[model samples]
Target: MSEEDTALKAIEQVVAAVQRTQREKDAEGFLALFHPDALWTTAHGKVLIGFDAIADFTRSVLPGASWDGEVTYDVVHTQFLRPDVAAVKVRQLYTDAEGRPESEGAPLYVMTRGGDGRWLLTACQNTQVRAA
Candidate 1:
């Protein structure tokens, strides 16, 4: 595969991981996808710095979130800043038991390729998509 293809593939895997963990409500699995010093801003605008804060928040919310539905994440776009860094935009949808949309989020992730050739989310911001 070409370099672009490889990078895209790697990024897709990261996106898949995010969706998988969210659907499973597995906080640890989701936390593992982020870098140790990553920064994340929640949909509500709260900032979390480092893996510890992220893990704390994820563990608190993932298991007890009111919505019991399928969480789907779609990668809307990706732009490479360099061979090892990418900015990814994702659309997240939560469907209710009846498969109707419950809520939506638009998240942007800055991912960096580690020395191990794995993409780790380095910075992220999640925004709630509210109807105007």
Candidate 2:
């Protein structure tokens, strides 16, 4: 596969890992998609750094929620900053326990290729979309 193809595959893996986490409420599974020092910022400007913190946050948020449907992600774009660094924009959509449409604004993810040539999330930021 070409370098772009490989990088895209890695991004897909990360997205798939997120889906699995949603299904199983497995924070550890979600943490596997990130680098050890990854940074995550929510639309509300809350920031969480490192895989352990991310795992803890996920565990706290996912289990008590009663979600009847799966969360879905739509990749908006993928940009390769270099052979080893890439960024992706994606839209996240889901329904909350109250049956309200819970859609996070578009989020950007920065990924870096590790020494093993696998892409791991380095940073993520969510852009809040005001309700119309």
Candidate 3:
């Protein structure tokens, strides 16, 4: 495969892991996707400035999150900012326990390729799609 294709595949893998981790409520696994200095803004407007802060939040909330449904992350678009950086847009869906859609989100992830060649979530914003 070409270089760009390989990168895209790697990015998709990261996103898939996100879906899996969120579904399983595995906070550690979810944290594994981030860069040490990553920045994150949640749909509810909470901003997490670094991995430590993010970890604290995830550990405290994920396990007990009622969710009441399944969550999914689908990569809708990806833009390569450089050979090692990418801007990825994801469609986040929350479904009822019976699989009915409940809510949706638009998340933008700025990922960077680490020195070890793994893609890391460097910066991100998760925005809820509110109905007008």
Lowest lDDT 10-residue stretch of candidate 3 = 61-70
Best by TM-score: 3
Worst 10 residues of 1 by lDDT: 62-71
Candidate 2's TM-score: 0.83
Compute the lDDT of residue 79 as modeled in candidate 2.
90
Give lDDT for model 3: 0.95
Q: Which pairs clash in the backbone of model 2?
A: none
lDDT of 3 by residue, 3-80 (tens): 999999999999999999888889999999999999999999999999999999999998887778889999999999
Which structure is stronger by TM-score: 1 or 3?
Answer: 3
Candidate 1 lDDT by residue in tens digits, 1-132: 998998998899899999998888889999999999999999999999999999999999988766766888999999999999999999999999999999999999999999999999999999999988
Residue 52, candidate 2: Cα error in Å is 2.9
Model 2 residue 6 CA deviation in Å:
2.1
Where is model 3 more than 4 Å wrong at Cα? none
lDDT by residue for model 2 (1-132), tens = 986887788787787777677678776677778899999997788899888787788778867756676676677789989888888898777767665777656889898989998788899997876668
Clashing pairs in 3: none
